[model samples]
Target chain A: MSNLKGWKEIPIGGVIDKPATSRLYKTGEWRVSRPVIDREVCINCMQCWLYCPDMSIEGSIEGKRMKLGEFKMEYCKGCGVCAAVCPVNAIVMKPESEFIDE
Target chain B: MPVKLTVTGAHAVAQAMRQINPDVVAAYPITPQTPVVEYYATFVADGMVDTILVPVESEHSAMSAVVGAAAAGARTMTATAANGLALMIEIVYIAASYRLPIIMPLVNRALSGPLNIHCDHSDAMLARDSGWIQFFTENHQEAYDFTIIATKLAEKENVLLPAMVNLDGFITSHGVESFEMLDDEVVKEFVGTWNPKYSLLDTENPVTFGPVDLFDYYFEHHRQQEEAMNNAYEELPKVFEEFAKISGRKYDFLDLYKTDDADYIMVVMNSTASTAKYVVDELREEGKKVGLIKPQVFTPFPKKEFQKALNGRKGVVILDRAMSFGKEAPLYSLIKSALYEVPSRPKLGSYIYGLGGRNTSPKMIRQAFEDAFNDNLVADEQRYLGLRE
Candidate 1:
């Protein structure tokens, strides 16, 4: 909280200067499990992208085909709605401690 | 040129609203306060003013709609009393937290339990800590004058807080009085146009209002509001000076009547102040050294001015219309806290008077003052004036 500016420095009326600035809080630390997507079994269906509560998942479209983009770890609060909505079992929620950097 | 007119306090407020001609007015009708909106609605219907009058279904919706309009960068106002104000309590806090600068005329009435509707200070006292600036008016003239002044003060760049001008219900709201009213053009010039520093409608410089402020930033935002309130206290005299230049009617945080060489003093608010003045004059003619301190601005508590006026008095009595129930009355407690540090503070007494529009005459006021003078120094019990056993 000390990192945030003092009362005098903040915008009048508590208005955020930039949209989607909640990403500055690093809410990903609250997540117990992280969602990982399997590209091979992924059927270009944007179900997970649509269901992501934090808008942390971006969809990458090549020409007429759409695929999953990189997950934004900064904003993901570990809500598993995206994993529950994936029809093809392409996305899985894995324990954060068990997962090693690839 | 200012002209004299005989009108109810509610109509005087409506007349002020017409002169201001705000961008929006969202209101619901409650007794006493009903005519204020009714008259404004006629102005809107007859093409007298270019204001979007929203005759909202309830006071809650009225306040909510006004909040939205004010946030959208439109000058807005509303009027309500007692139960209507009670229903709007939730949004009242929201409006102040957002610093919307909305002006409201809160017609004072008794908050009901057994359901009685008349004049009292309970309604205004309920919102005392809601972070809105409050002004208590003695008559229709101050009611009209303060409404316009409240608009300018609320919209000041340094002080973007909501404000409420309180006129006693039925006593002043329904009673007609003749008072000088400023010309429309002169009022328009005095209030001027509202230039919001940041607005929700400013697409080019977008801003978010009423955001979820958690532990990290909520305190800081509250501090900002405190700073704004402090700024309002400092900015009020300047605003009063400017208004006086045009209208020749000066005002201050507190109105002092014969406090210079007085040994006994009475402090009160609203229309009761006028009654106290009559008592004070009569006491003076009989060679009694008594004075009166009528607090005009209730919020920000006007601590400094009150301390200066009350220091070195022999005895002081405070009259409160609302009961704090289980504790000291609101105005009495406020005065005690304010004068706590005064070097030779006066012996203070508290009296609860005129609840539910009980008649408070000059004789009753004089008796209270006499009781305060004769009471023992250490006695601190509250006396209920005119309350039958």
Candidate 2:
């Protein structure tokens, strides 16, 4: 947010000074429920990664096997699309306030 | 040597474009404006100009393509009329809001309901609040001259706003007239290369072009646009001064004809002013104290200049080529607002004339002046000239 300037300092077209400030805003606060992934049962189908509206899911290939990477909590609005699209039920939508990190 | 040519307003604009040799021209055709782009397209085909001519499917795409090209740091232009302008109006506002200095030669035509393809100011009037600087031209000479002038004004460093050079459809656009053409080298020197402060292609200075400006910053951006508009009003005379040096033709916010000591004056714009000038001359020979005021620049309204021109006149008649429906005509209401703070103002009368290309002869214009004079210098109500009922 420090990158943001007062209205007077902004250019004529309301151009942003920095590129892609979405990384700085933690949109997770906007969510009432959050998705928790169960890696053990996850088939690595990459369906959740493709279905996430906020593009919070990441996928990678490891030794000829596909695997899910870290979830970007800063941008995840906790939309249940990722959890609902999981064919193997490897993801669950837990209440945001009740979920505690290990 | 300066060349002379007898050509239509559309061809004159094409000749100007050829001399300017813009970076891109993206346009789709509409009636009365097709010849403008058509002529330029031939130049492009013959390798006369190094412009990228984008023949888009629709006016929306035309404007969209130009917006993209202009954001990418290219000097751009386009032409449209009537329904074509209406179709591209959504992007027209975006072009101004983005501060892209695109020059559009807008041929004025009536907005359709009965679907008439004729000359009127309705199309240009509809885009009055769209933030583009508008210059209304009287004839083919002005149509050619203002296009070059508009390019310089739009590209001013402190006043980077889009501009429209408006000429009446069919009347000026199709009518051929003889005018002196500036030397190609002189035109190139007059309108120098466009220098953009920030462009989409500026990788080292990576800045966003258009961003999602919310409630927090949207108002401020608008304030900046307003400031730029004010700057345009100030910067216009300086450009006209420079242009006059080479061209030897003087220009101002409005053209005044024998209004200095006249008692009755008619305020109008575009081709009708030429007809009214004859009426003024005939009335003057009859010893009637009548004059004429023709405004060239429509946007930035030039309130103070108009007030000064209209000062001390006994009766002033304003003619509108387009109607405003439930209220007073557009120019009439605007003139009233311009004179709002003046301590003394001339008695104001308005008439809606030339709707859907109805003929406004010298006789009808003479009657407008006569009506104003016979009304005892009191503006009773608005009237329509040449209306059957």
Candidate 3:
């Protein structure tokens, strides 16, 4: 919270100076839920990566996504779209409080 | 040499638009404002200016097209009235939020229910909080000048925001008055060309506009928009001064006529101010010190200027062409807030008149002044000038 820029420091007109800077804005701080992946049950079908609106699902880009990958927690907005799209029930939405570090 | 032409307020605005020759004009016509787009489209059709005139389906599309066009780094403009302005107002906020300097000429008319096409300011008042610089013109001449000035002001580096140049519905929009139009070359050079700091077309330095800004940053962006209004209030005079150099018509936040030594000052807006000034003359002939303060710039509200202008007066009467429904009239409420911190404030009275083009005759104006100087004014004396019981 202390590090966030004040009104005077931000650019005028809500115009993001460079495209794709949304990656820099962390949305996980107050997100109510987060997606949890069960690696044992996960089939690397890559549906979550393709369906993620925030593009928070991260994995290898060799066209196969053969192994499970880490979540880009900073950009994830806790929408269950990625979880809902998983072909196997490997990804699930959980209360962010369960994983939040004190 | 200035061209001498007798033209309606709408045509005068079009003549200025033709001179501005903005990159794009997307407009859907409404009465009183129809002639403005009609004339500008003809200019575009005739190759008078290299402008793309997009005849849109509705006022909503009209504003949407201009917003998209302006965002694409094109100098853009549009015109609408009353319900048309109402239709476009949602995108109008977006236009300001993105800080696109689109110039819109608003033909003031009453918002509907008892739908009638005539002069009143309820239309413009609807946009008071929409984050655009607002200029109210008293007649056709001002309609012409402000259209050109708005182009320069809206795109002024410090104030990159949309602006509305307002003319009373049919009274000013359809009123034909001869005004000296600036030579085309002079105006072209005066406004110069738009060199924006950020543009949608600047592919080299790619930028994003109208992003899904959330709480973490939305406040900062909206705060920036809010502060731009202050930047505009400060930059307006310099822009007006520059226009004055080109057109020889000096402008300020308030156009004060015989106000300095008056015991009572009357504040009015749009064409109604002309009537107020005439009554002031009639009263002055018999040695009553009444004067007129017409706000050339209405959106910024010119709070400090109003505080200074109304400080030492014995009394002040505000005439409004629209009502606030639940409050004292619009102009009256603004003047009240402006006077809050003044060291010596005048007694204030509000006289709402001419809603939906009801006639505000000299007789109605006289009644306010006749009562103003009697030293019986309250802090908030709300009265109807010409409404018959």
TM-score of each: 0.86, 0.84, 0.88
Once fitted onto the true fold, the runs of candidate 3 whose alpha carbons sit more than 4 angstroms away are A33-102
The list of candidate 1 runs beyond 4 A from truth reads A20-22, A28-102, B376-379
lDDT of 3 by residue, B112-203 (tens): 95988888889999999999999999998899999988888889877899999999988888888898999999999988998877878899
* Deviation from native of the Cα of residue B330 in model 1, angstroms: 1.0
Q: RMSD of model 2, in Å?
A: 6.7
lDDT of each: 0.89, 0.89, 0.88
**Each candidate's fnat, in order?**
0.57, 0.66, 0.91
Q: Comparing 1 and 3 by DockQ, which wins?
A: 3
Question: Tens-digit lDDT track for model 2 on B1-389?
Answer: 78889999999999999998999999999998999999999999999999999999999999999989988899999999999999999999999999999999999899997898899999999999999999999998999999999999999988999999999999999999998899999999999988887888888777787877765567878888898899999999999999899899989999999988898899889999999999999999999999999999999899999888887677899999988888888898999888878777889988889999999999889988997778644454888788898
Give residue B117's lDDT in candidate 1 (0 to 100).
88
Question: Which is better, 2 or 3, measured by TM-score?
Answer: 3
Q: Rank the candidates by DockQ, best first.
A: 3, 1, 2
Between the candidate structures 1 and 3, which one is better when assessed by TM-score?
3
TM-score of chain A of each: 0.70, 0.70, 0.69
Across A21-66, the per-residue lDDT of candidate 2 in tens digits comes to 6565455555778888888999889889989988898888999987
